[model samples]
Each structure stands twice: as structure tokens, then as C-alpha cells.
Target: MTGLGDSRHVVVVGASLAGTRTAQNLRALGHTGPITLIGAEAELPYDRPPLSKDLLVSDWSDETVEGFRLATSAELDDLNLDLRLGVAATALDPDTRQVTLADGASVDYDVLVIATGAAARPSPWRPASGLLQLRTLSDARAIAARLALREPVVVVGGGFIGTEIAAAAIKLGCPVTVVDPVAEPMTRIVGPEVAGSLVDLHRANGAATRFGVGVVDIRGEAGALTVVLDDGSELTASTAIVGIGSVPGTAWLEGSGLTLDNGVVTDARLRAIGVDDIYAIGDVARWPHPGLGAHRAEHWTNSSDQARFVAAAIAQDAVLEYSSTDYVWSDQYDWKVHTVGWRDPQGSSVLVGDLAADGRVAVVHADADGNACGAVTINWVRALNQARRLLMAGDTAEAIAEQLEQLTVRAA
Candidate 1:
């Protein structure tokens, strides 16, 4: 074992949010170890959520683009990092603790953090042309170019990404239609108490929706395409953007001997199962969560939180097990959607405020014993803040709803 000290070298795969934050946190925690950050994309690490929320709609300037960067060139140099961008880790040899890069080069490390993250699921309905997916800055730029054409667009998913893009297209004066296989695609996500309201939000904002049908096939080229649905219906569009989901970037680790399930399975301490000195974090790492059992979170907060946790454990020799409530936020059209903790379908849900009447809503979920477990708030930051505070303190659904109602009245 190469001991855990400032003298050891730490290699991080994937220079996105999780990986970059891991290195930053290590440095902040006073670990002067030699750190090598490997990234597949040539671009410096940047924020991703804005790609769907703002980049597609705004007339961004050079300074605005620079703002997206996690750190500037000078800032990175100050960290004294061996930043290896435009190259990806090809293979890993755990026995030797060496990572081989794509350019026929290998780097050794005493500590390794598998923050490689997940990639967008490839579109299955391949047309002659004009298909898009958002996973990288380059991908966002390509989609922005297509969206600039001001032609009709079909977003083939009803999730957060798809809806955000749809909202952006609508703002761009493009005819937009969102298609999803599930009747209420958000039911499984935001829950039944408020899913329909969110779907109606898009309709109210001038975007057509074709729910309860799956895309069977797509044909034609860019600016003129046909989308065939499973329900024997067809829709024509100039472009189609698939925001289905993402898969862990574990293909390169095929024979690496890591217990790969949906992601790199990690124990309670966020350490890769059955391995010493190697840890996994972010979307690519499935850690044993205290609240939800073995779980993998794809939210931005989850990745950032896990990075800090893992870095503390490594740099400061922290012994606490990793724990966090699931949190996700999205900017869809004119409303801000914020969800904290998990949404339990089996648990009781209390709804406060009406979306149609007031354009704001909050849903608090309570466990079997009437303890607040999770919450979703839309266009109501105060209520969201209170819910998060009360949830952490284990408040009851009734009490949460009453306080939210009081807040609603005061705001009114």
C-alpha cells in the first residue's frame, strides 16, 4: 500500500464536475499530493445545467462563456495539477494501481477516484439526420445551432432535460412537441400530486405534447423529418432531440474487476467494493446510501456532495460514512422546480397551493409514520427552503403543509 499522505499521487478520471471537484477539495483540504485529472473532452470543466436551461436560449458572449468554466487556466495552474484534458483513461490495472490512457500512455497512482460519470444514452430512432442529445458542451453547441434554424422540433422524452430543451425551443419561436412513452412521465419522478401540473405547464407555455406513445421509428433528413409513434401515429419535425437518460461510463472498465452494476458499486464509505485505496463518486459510482439503501444519484448536487465526502475521507482521514438526501433542481420555462429528498409513492403526500390558481405548488411526502420524507416545490423558494429545513429535522407532513399554507397566505 502506498500510504495516504501529501507525498502520494492521486489520479482522477473524468474532469467533469465530480472529478474536478474531487481534485479541488483535496487541494483545499491541504493535500499537496501530485494530482492528475483526466478528461475525455478537450474543454476545461464547466457547469452543465446551463447547457439546457440557458445556453440554448440566450445570446451568450465571450465573457458569458468563460463564466461557465469551473476554473480558469490560471486558477488550475495554481492548484499545481497535472491536468490531462482531451485524453481518456482506457484501461485500469487494480493490481498495479495504474491507469492507461487512450494515447498509449499509462499513469500510476496511490489513490484513484472513479468519477468518470455517465454518458447520454444513444438515440435508438436514428433518422437520416437531425438528431440531438445533450451531454457535453460540444453537444449543447450542436443542438443550439440546430435550434437556431427556427424549425419545428420534437423532443423525445418528458424528463427534465427534454422539457428544458422544449421550453428553450418555444422561447426561440420554434414549434415544439414533447413525446414520451408514459402517459404522465413525471409521475415516477415528481409524483402524482404534481406531475400532471408540470406537464400542463409546458402546454400552457405553447409546447405541444404527445404523451402515452413511444417513438417507433424516425425517417428523413434534417429540416424535414418524420417521427413514427408506437400508437400508429406520425409527427413531422425539422429536428428531434433525445433526452432519454444516461448510462454509466464503465465500458472502458470492462475487465478492471470492479463490481460494476448500474455503476461502480461502493460501500458505505463511498469506497469501491472489495478494493482498498480506490474510491468511486458521482453518477458513475453507486454508493450504499443510508436512506435509500444501495443507490446511484445522477443529480448535480449528488455528484458534488459525493466528491466532497470522498475527498474528505481521503485527505483528512475522515471516518464518517457517506450520507445525503437526494436533491434536484430544474428551470423549466418560467418556473423553478426544486425537489429535495426522495418521493415515495407508497408514502402519504400532502399538496399545498394550486398550480392553476396561483402558478405555485408544493408537495410534501410523509412516511408511514407521518414523518416528512421528501418534498417538491415549484416557483416557491420560501416553501422549498422551509421544507428542506423541516425534512432534515424530521417534521410531519401536516405540520409542513400548515406552515407552507401560512407562507402562501403571507406571500399572497
Candidate 2:
């Protein structure tokens, strides 16, 4: 209502990494306003990246959620935020500046932040049992338990999340099969050159591939489920993970007068278009990029960066437009894959190191005009760091490749 330490009530929907981090950054930026942190899950805000990796591969307990929590009960108390866990924001009235919770109550807010993130796109084929999609801690726990049985696992996508889950299941000694309709699913993101290596990596690690076909229907239940492929083939598995994709968590905002296409469309500053006193971040927000046009990035780094930017604007009236590093990473078996920026198919790419001959490698990508735009590194941290710097600095693709090659030589 007043200034940073005033009595303004800031209600943040979606207690996710983005929501929690926004709250944290607001406090760190000296916003003493009453912040209401709402979440649909009862669990404390924990990191979701591990839901498909560490959480499934390793043995963990219900309490393991706390180990990955972004903040604890004590920390929330220290920040003096009103904790509204296990209840979702069912309705939002931007005109009235009020949030209607599922608990039949309403809270007035001077400012509202939407960071609900996303939910795994629901599987069209739902059997009586044995179908799972990893998007939350509970989902991860259930999936971990299923994989622990060391039975067959059919991951219904070859994208990063699905592949990561498949890797986890394979590591647990489960016979795994990755099913995808898009033959080379990663071609759009990582290009065909790298996608081939990824396919090899999966085969090298003992994960089966059923690409170029999709599951038309699934029958039976866990431990006896039958995956019916569109090509009239069938694969029996103990469990099936449908990681085809995800949808932005915007169902609750349907009648809230907010524009939602793929997500909450925002301006350059991430403020919800056509509304004042409201902002959207994380997977739920699709903001414009100076170079890449408008799109939503589900990467963890984007969430962190957007949260801090929005908090600074609210706390200090900051004017700098938000710019993302566009960074992402994944762990499949023993490989550590890191990607910086987007890969342009129309542009050219330069391979710096040999992944087969060498243990690590880097692929530098350039735009049509030869400006370095992106890089992908496998098990090579130094190359990743250098790639990030060079790409961010707008180095030529050739320049990036040369420098990475020099670094490779030095390491050798």
C-alpha cells in the first residue's frame, strides 16, 4: 500500500520454484509486505528437476521432500508470509484485486503474482492402473516405487524428461523402452547431429527404443499393462511414464479475464497483458524475447531469472527488461548434458570435440549470419562455461568453435 515495508498484501499463486523464489527474492529485496504463498500440494516448495532424476534413481522417503525444499517452515515464518499450502487458487479477480481459494475463502491483494508452473499433459490412454506422469513430489515417489520393482518400464516419450525417467528406470535394472512418434524427437531442439548421439547413448546404456511410432491405447494395469502401438505392435510393461509434454497451469484462471494462449501472455516486463498490478513468471508465463520472439521456456534457469526480475520491479521499481540465459541441463546415465541458448536449424553448427573419441564434446551453433547463438556440451563443464560466455557475448560460431577447440587441447 505504501512503500517496500508497507502494508501491501502480495498474493503469489502456485507455491512452485518460481513462486517460492519470487517470494524469497522479494524478501531479499526488502519487501516487508504481507506475502501470501499458496500451493495446491501440501508438501513444502521443493525442487522439481530431481523428480525425474535423483528422486527416481535413488532411495528416498517421504521426508526426502524436505531435503529439496526451497524454504522451510521456519524460513517462511522468518519472512512472515502467510502459508496457504494444500489449497489452490481457484479463481482470480484482477479487477477486484482478490484471489478466491478452493477453501471457500477470499483474500484481497494489492498485487498478485501468478507462477503456477505446469502439469504433465494428461495421457489420452489411461488404464485402470499402472500409468504415471512425473510432475510433482508425490508423482515422483510413486514412480520411484514402481521402478524399484525392477520390472519393465515403457517411457512414452524420447524428450529430455521422458528420457531422464527412462534412464532412472534403466539404472534400477528395469528393462526400459522409450516410445516416440517423432522418430528423432530432439531434432527440433538439439538438431539431428546431436540427436543421433543421444540415441546411441540410450542404446549404449541398455534402454530400448521404439521410435517412429506412438501408443494408440493402453490396456490392463501395473505389472501387466499392455501398450498398444499405432503400428499394431504391442509392448508389455510393468509401468508406463507418459512424458509427452505439459500444459501451462492456467485452468484456474479461465474466467479471470487474463489472456491465456499457451500460457499467460506477458509483455517484455512479464506483466500480464491488459492487467495492472499482476505479473506471471515460470512455465506459466510466455513473454516476448528480443531475438527468439515470444515463447515459454520450461527450464529451471528461466524460472529463477524471471522471479528475481519481477521481484526487483516490485520492490525497487526496476526498469531493466528481463533477459534469460536460456540455459538447460540433464543427466542421462553417466552423461551430463548442458545446453545454452536455442539451436537454429537454418544456421550452421561446428563440432569442437569428439564424443566417441573423447569423453566430452561441445557443439557450437550459429545463426544464419554466423553469430554464435547456442552450444551443447556433454560431460564438459569447462566448454559449457566458455560456450555460455562466448554465445552471450555474440561471438561468431567459428570463433566459439576455435576457442572451445583450444580449451580441449589444453585439457588434453
Candidate 3:
């Protein structure tokens, strides 16, 4: 198979985890062609997961945070990539194979990879000072500085990031409250059983909850913000962190003739629908999964997995249908929550151990047909690994549950 060869120039947008990994993989695969990496932020690519995790809770210096850099200056130089930083892609012209930058300059490419990733969904309530959202390193630094003050904090969402931020704030001895409209905010991701345990864990760690409520308005200045609830109640806090969700960064491809429904719609091979020589990955691409059907994965593992797959595909290597085990994890207090595959709350769930007593439990979920769909385990790394292997091996949910039950009983 003849790869693009050393002649074709590949342009990758978004110098993020997905983008950086893709560029590095391309070089590793012996693609000696000209590779250009573009990023909107001025800083080099860094890990985003730590932005809400260790960066917010610990008093780590900027150098320590730089340890999370995906690629150092030396490594990037070794890759021989034309690194373009602090410039945003304003528009994409598929017909001309050109990408216009924010500086009114355009770059032509033989092949284009859209790994633009996603942006933090802005909160409707914007206070001049205390309101914050964590997406970039800058945002995390601001939140960490505010958390150091140990003032009262109100988190306006109860999703994974919101809950994680709340946990970090609680560690700082700040009175924290998590507000969400849904009863169990993350039930759709980790299923009802595990999400319920998470809520309890937060409460046990001195974090307050305002579940089943929505934010009506945010009033006051930065130092003191009043959060008004839909139920006509109010809570005052020194700072507010919004972790609602994120939207794809595909606005530049608006008139590029590519299908954009929530994200750039791609086929099973990660190729953009209706466009040749263009591929999409990471949070910006909604591709078809064999089990889950069509969906966009926002997890860190998904981004890296897609990057490796796309890199291999571009190098004319053995291309396999993109199939991910779909793993995601969260850290709340001392508990480590891990999940694999898909978890459906409406489906049958088999619980192996007691979440309250053992502090370790695994919930195996099955579809209506009784086939294994996913599993969620709390502080049970062995059980989680076992479930992942069995799920990938086509084991039935009932069969996996029986094995998990035996393991839990033996551990007891």
C-alpha cells in the first residue's frame, strides 16, 4: 500500500489531545510528508483531564502543570511539524482545499483532519466576576486561585465535571453546593445505581446537593454572587463554577458542505460524510458505533483511540472498523469510579456488591434482549477489567453477572 508519501501535506486543526496524538502517530507511522498542526490557544498542547482534577484541588505550580504537556518543545521539534499556535481557523473551503485563519491567511492542504474538539458550553448566567467555567488551562488556573480562598462555592451543574469540581472545592474546606435540574444527573452515563452511589459519596464528603432544581438567575458581583433557583429559593456564594456541557467546535465548517448534526457526521471509517480527503475525529466527529449506533464520545480514551485509528488508516495500514471498549473514569474524594461499554438505566442491572458496606460494587447492564451492554464498577479495578474483557468477548450480561457475583463473594 502506497501511503500519501513524502509529497502530500496533511493539515490538522485543533492542537489538542486528539490533534497532537494524531500528528505524532502520523510521524511514527513513517509518513514523512509535511505535517502542519494548528491551534487556537497559544500554549502547547496539554492534558485536559487534569484541569478539573489535580489542578483545581492541589496547589501545583505552573511548571508542575506543564508536566501534563502532551508534547514538549523538543518532542514537537523532533516530529518536524509546522506548529501554528494562537491562530483560529475561521473558515473551511472544501472545494479549494483551503483553511482560512483568523489572521486572514489561508493554508492549503492535500489532506485535512478536523480534530477541532469541543468548547465548554457557556452558562446563561454570567456574573461579571465570580462565575467560572473550566475548559482551558487558563480557566483552571482562575478556578484554582478562587478555590484557594476557601470561600463558599456553588456549582451550577451536577454532571461529571461539575461533580468533580465540587469534590475539589470540598477538599479545600469550601462550603460547596451542586445544583442540577435532574434527580440523578449522571444516570444516563453511569446508570442509576452507580450515579446514586456517587451522589451519596459527595454528600458524605461534606458537599451539599440541590438536585432536582434549576438555576433561574445569577445576581451580584464577582466576590458575592446570588444564585436564584427555579423554586424561588436563593443561595449566595463567593464563587460559582458552571460545568453544564460542551459543544463541538465546528462553526468554521458551516458552509463547507459537510453534514453537521450536533457534530461532523462521519461514516464508520471516520471519513467525513460527503467529502473526500477529509476525516474527523475527537469530540467534533459523530461516528457510527456497532453497539451504540451513532454517537459522539467525549471521553479521553475515545479521543486517543480515534487518533490511533485515523493515523493507521492514513498510513495505508490494516484498517479495522473503529470499535472502542468505551471506557471513562472519575475521581470523587477517595472513590475511583470506572465504567466500560454502555450503561442503560432503563435496562436490566445486576448489582454484585453493596456500595455502602463494601465501598466496592459492580453493576452489569444488559439490553432488553439480555445481552451485555456495559458495566460500572466503583473501586473495583479487577472487576472492571474482567467486565471489559468479557464484554469484548461477547459474553452475556447474565454470565458476566454470575462471574462478578462469585468474585465479590470470594472477596468477602
Candidate 4:
């Protein structure tokens, strides 16, 4: 495999984890290209998971959210790659191989990597002032300031981000209430049984869980928010944090001719189907998985891994078939919950280990053939490691259970 065409002009969008990793890999793979890193955010690329966890509770300053730079100023200076920050790509012309920026600048690319991650989905009903969505560093900083006041916080949506924010608010000694339309929290992701555990945990922590309730409207400024539920009940709070979900940042690709279902459709190689010389990765990419079949994973592990795979492919190497180890973790209430592989809802769900009061729990999702479709462990590091190993070895759930029993005995 030789360098496809002149690999001199490489353009990457988004500057998020996936974009940064892809840039790093492009250089590391011996591609002598003038890489251009473009980002819409004013600040340098930063980590996001901590924004909902430690940043909310800790006294971390706003400037601390600069994030881990894949290539520092010195490194970037040495590499001499063009760095364009706070500018959005407005359009893409595949025929001309050019990207038009919002500033009316055109960047021609020999090869383009689309890593324009997703933005937090805005609430349908706008607040009197404005609803809050924690996606960027600025968003996180503002939320942290509100939580520091130790005032009543109302969080809409029970997804991982919302739950983590709610738990962080509780830890910050603020009155917290979570309102979700679902009959149970996290029912859409982990089903009723797992959701039940979360329900109990939230209650035990003294956080109000208003299940089956939907927020019809939010009124008032950032200092005071009035939340009207679907049942016509109203609750006033000092702050309202909305984390319904996220949508792909692909509005710029409206007429790109590349498929965009929930996100940019890609094959297993993370290459956009029907589009040549372009690749998409991260939260905005929906690619087929070998183990989970055709599915788009919005996990951090998936983003970074996909970036590496795409980078190798870009370098024209004899690329290995893309497959995921399927790792994702969330932090809340002193518990570290990790999941490897997609949870097969139709498969059998089993609680293999007791979490006890300390928030240690392990559960496995098995297919009809007893293969491990997914595994989730709360505050159980050993269980997470074993699950990851089984996923890599392609072991079935029944075999994993047998191995888990031995682990329990050893712990005993």
C-alpha cells in the first residue's frame, strides 16, 4: 500500500477527541501531510466526561477545562499544521474537494476527515431566559457556578449525563429533582431492573425522583426557574439543567449527498458509504459493528478507536478489520459504572454479582445463544476487567458466568 495521491493536504474537522487522535495518527503513520485542525469551539480541545462529574462538585476553575491537547502549542508549532479555531465549516463540495467555512474561506483538501462531533440536543420548550445544555467548556462552567450556590436544581432527562449532574448537585449539598417521562429512570438504556437499582440509589441519596413526569415548560431566569410538569404541576427551583440528549452536528452536510440517518452513515471501516476520500468518526458517525451488527455507538471508546482505524486507513496501510472492545464508563455517587459491548435488550439479562451497599454490581446481557452481548459493572473494577477480556476473546455469557463464579470465590 502506497500513499494514495499526494498526501500533502489533509483536513480534519471538529478538533474533538476523535479529530485530535486522527490528526496524531496521520502524522504517526508517516503521512507527510500538512494537517489542518479545525474546531468550532474557541477553546482548545478538552475532555468532556469530567464536566458532569468532578467539575460540577469541585472548585475547579473555568480555565481548567482546556482539555488534554493531543498536540501542544510547541508540538503543533513544530509540525506546522494549520490550526483554525472557532470557525465552522458551512459546506462541503466533494467535486472540488473543498470545505467552505462560515467566514467564507475555502479550504481545499486532498483527503478530508469529518469529525464534527454532536451538539447537546436543545429542549423543545424554551425557557423565559434560556435552557442550559452542558456540552462545551463554557456550558460546564456556567452549570458549576449555579451548582456552587447550593440552590435547588431541577434536571430533566435521566440519561447518564443528567443523572451524573443530579448526583453531583446532591453531593454539592443542593436540593435536586429529576423529572423524566419514562415510568422508570434509564429504562430506554438498561431496562427496568437496572433502572430500579438507579431509582433506589437516587432515593437513598435524598435526591427527588419524579418518575413518569415530563417538563412541559420552564420559565424564569437562570437565578430562578419554574418547571411545569405534564401533569400541570409546577416546581420552582434556582437552576434547571436539561440533558435530554444530543444530535449529530451534521446540519452542514445537508446536501452533501452522503447518507445521514441518525448520523453520517459509514461502513465498518468508518468510511462514509458512497463517498470516496472522506471518513467520519465519533458521536456523529453511525457505522456497522462486527459484534453488535449494524449500530452507532456514542461511546468515548468507540470515538477514539474509530479515529485510530480511520487514520490507518487514510495512510493506505494494510488495515485490520475494524471491531470494538466496547468500553464505556460513567461516574456518579462514588460509583464507577462501566459497560463493554452493546446490551442486547431481547437477550437474557442476569445479575452475576452483588453490588452491595457500596454500589458494586455486575450484570450481563446474553443472546439466545448465551453469548455475551453486553456487560455492565458498577464500582466493580475486577468485573469490568473480566468482561473486557471476555469481549476481546469472544467468549459467551455462560462461559463468562463460570469465570465470574471463580472470581467471586477468590474474593471470598
Report the lDDT of model 4 for residue 5. Answer: 46
lDDT of 1 by residue, 165-222 (tens): 9999999899999999998888877888888888888999999999999999989989
How do the residues 190-292 of candidate 3 rate in per-residue lDDT, one tens digit apiece? 8887788788888889988999999999878777899999999999999999988999999999988999998999988898997768999999999998667
Could you give me the TM-score of model 3 versus the true structure?
0.97
- Across 1-412, the per-residue lDDT of candidate 4 in tens digits comes to 3554435588998888888888887777777868898899866677778888876676674445433345566766666679898999999988888999998999999778999989999788677763678998789878877888888989998889999999998998899999998878676566555678887788889899888988888988876778999999998888898999899989998898888888888876777887767888999988888656667677788889988888888776545668887888887687677887767667786776666643567777786666778788877889879877886687878787677767877877
User: Considering summed lDDT, which 10 consecutive residues are worst modelled in model 3?
Assistant: 1-10
lDDT of candidate 2 over 119-168, digit per residue (tens): 99999998999999989988998998898899999999899999999888
Q: What's the lDDT for all of these models?
A: 0.89, 0.89, 0.89, 0.80
Which candidate would rank higher by TM-score, 3 or 4? Answer: 3
* Colliding residue pairs in candidate 3: 130-222
Kindly report which residue stretches of model 2 are placed more than 4 angstroms away from their true locations once superposed.
1-3
The TM-scores of all predictions, comma-separated, are 0.97, 0.97, 0.97, 0.94
List the candidate 1 regions with Cα displacement exceeding 4 Å.
Answer: 1-5, 368-370
Residue 15, model 4, lDDT: 88
